[model samples]
Target chain A: MLFMRFRHLLFAIFALASGAAMAQNNPLTGLLRSLTNTVAPDQGKAAATNQPTSVMGVRGLDEVALKDATPAPAAVVELEKYAASAESATAAAKQTGLQERTVSYQKP
Target chain B: MTNFRLPVRFGVRFGVLSLIAILTSVVCAPVSAQTFNLNAIGSVVSGLVEGARVSNISEAEEIQIGKEISARVLGAAPLVKNEAAQRYLNRVGTWVALHTERRQLPWRFGLIESPTINAFAAPGGIILVTRGLYASLENEAEMACVAAHEIAHVNMKHHLDLIQKGALTQAGAKLLEMRSGGNEIKQFAIGQGAEIFTRSLDRGAELDADSKALVYVAAAGYDPGACPAVMKRLAAMKADASSLAMLYKTHPAPADRAVRMEEDLGKLAGAPAGSGLRPELATKIK
Candidate 1:
């Protein structure tokens, strides 16, 4: 009876040990472990670096680029003309009814 | 024998119970303990459901999209014919961009021929300033401020984000169904993406870009104040002017921008003193 009891105890121990080993090797457990160990830290690092979350929404500037841009010669001439006009407009607007709001950058 | 059976039974029960406890703990742990695992599962499930939908735009992809947009822009208004002016703008833009985190991007700068007082930034580091806006600047510092502002938009991925959220998501979905039909869907998406430039970014984004532009120009050792100076100029423009209409529509009022810049200036007081324009570049602009 004593021998039989000892054998049963050993069998039980073996069964328990094997069960634990199998559990440790389980794919789900491995995935969970990797997610906790790897993905979490990567996210933390990305956050710390202030990386952008997504880049999908930026495509709209083409229309602006197309609609607003002119050929270089025309653009340059127009720019020169615009500058002269803008200066005169500023002078005119100041002399007339429009009030000029001065925005100065003072060191605080 | 009965005693042996009892010990074996108890051991089996204990082991099974421990396994159950571990499984339960994994399932029922506090969210903080399990969030990563849960997110992994969610990503896998989403990947399966969304099939080929890209969650992030790669750098190569950004360049491709930028190229398509740029071609359309060139179609609308070609680059300034002056090689010297183009080179000068590139030099200045590259100088400012080098000071940014995304310096590795293939930075290209152009002067558009438009008389409109506006600037544009395409994804993957393409920047264009209207000859009109460029001509209005008094010095390189002012030009740097403008370039920096557009650079900020690229760095911040402002346009890229708009495309992704609006057209790209739909395009990606369609591309999966019609693999050989991808080009048509992509072109349609690109057209839709271009339309976003006509719309205004949320006020917060424009203001944020202003703040970032200030920092970038200051970092590049240009007067951060140049940005506000430009804002003041824009604010002073007649709202009824046709040239000013598109700019005003797409941006916050210059008065509001000036106010924001005024607030930002205080924080930038400690930045290094800015340099003036190089004599050669000054003469070239003249």
Candidate 2:
């Protein structure tokens, strides 16, 4: 019975080792491909649009992909509302004896 | 065989008892520390974890953070209050933004009512140009180049990276810890994050943004030479001028930047040498 138990333990260890080896071989390629697909679905479209492709080692900004891009109307409206509300709040705070300090850019 | 079984049982029991002791101390330590007002350890652990989590901020979170920072900036120095000028700036800025990777961002542009010749870009596509800087520009292209530079900073997530780096520090950690306490604490944490933006990004990031700005402007069908021209003008400014001091302090030496741009100018050869100032925009700003 002891010999049988020892054999079972060795088998379990071997199985775990092989599983780890498989995982190492397959690294996160699947996850990375999915992320790439989701983030940039316009790779083909960009190539066809005649955009100034990145030349001087700069990688991120693709002028072609942005050819048809426009600002979101909702975000613009929200920004305007925020500006108006912030203006009113500042005025009210000043009237209530709050000091208006310039935002400091000095290193801390 | 019986003797071997007895030892095995004892070993397992001893190991379980030791683990329980360790677990008890680990669970109770924080409560005991709190009772004694020793929250430094708690804050440190919480801050590091929070900082790591924020390093991978989602697109929506980035916009929210940018909004908070923009509000602080507006509170400090309000918009120029000229509707026509504001509208014109929005048009130009939106046009330039449309030529970059993140064209879909809200991309609001405002001219701040400040005499300091400086411009700022908050995350989520908010760009602010100072009245002094706008007044100094000779043409629409110059203004567009400046706006493009700020946009590059946003697109590259410079401010977000700075805030995340700040989070790893003691002050940042404490602020992050306070963020969980209540709404007031949350506001304070955001204010701290805003402060990080005001301090400026590293020199490398500033240069990278400058390079990207050239690419963006060139791609938008503007004369790429305008970027180096602006840098040369800035380089020639007197260091003591109050308007230039803040800008000078935060950026690399203008002369060095100009030299770098000169080297990279060859790469933008095919970009069109568009008109400096369009007739419609000229009369409005004037």
User: Chain A TM-score per candidate?
Assistant: 0.25, 0.26
Candidate 2, residues A54-103, lDDT tens digits: the string is 32111111122112223233443444633323334334323433332111
Give the number of the best model, judged by DockQ. 1
Off by over 4 Å in 2: A1-108, B1-55, B171-189, B272-286
Candidate 1 lDDT tens digits, B78-140: 666676677667666776776677978877777876777778787888787777777788767
What DockQ score does model 2 reach against the true complex? 0.02
Residue B39 of model 1 has an lDDT of 33
Task: Provide all candidates' interface root-mean-square deviations.
Answer: 15.5, 21.3
Distance from true location, Cα of A44 in model 2, Å: 50
To one decimal, what is the Cα RMSD in angstroms of model 1 from the true structure? 16.3
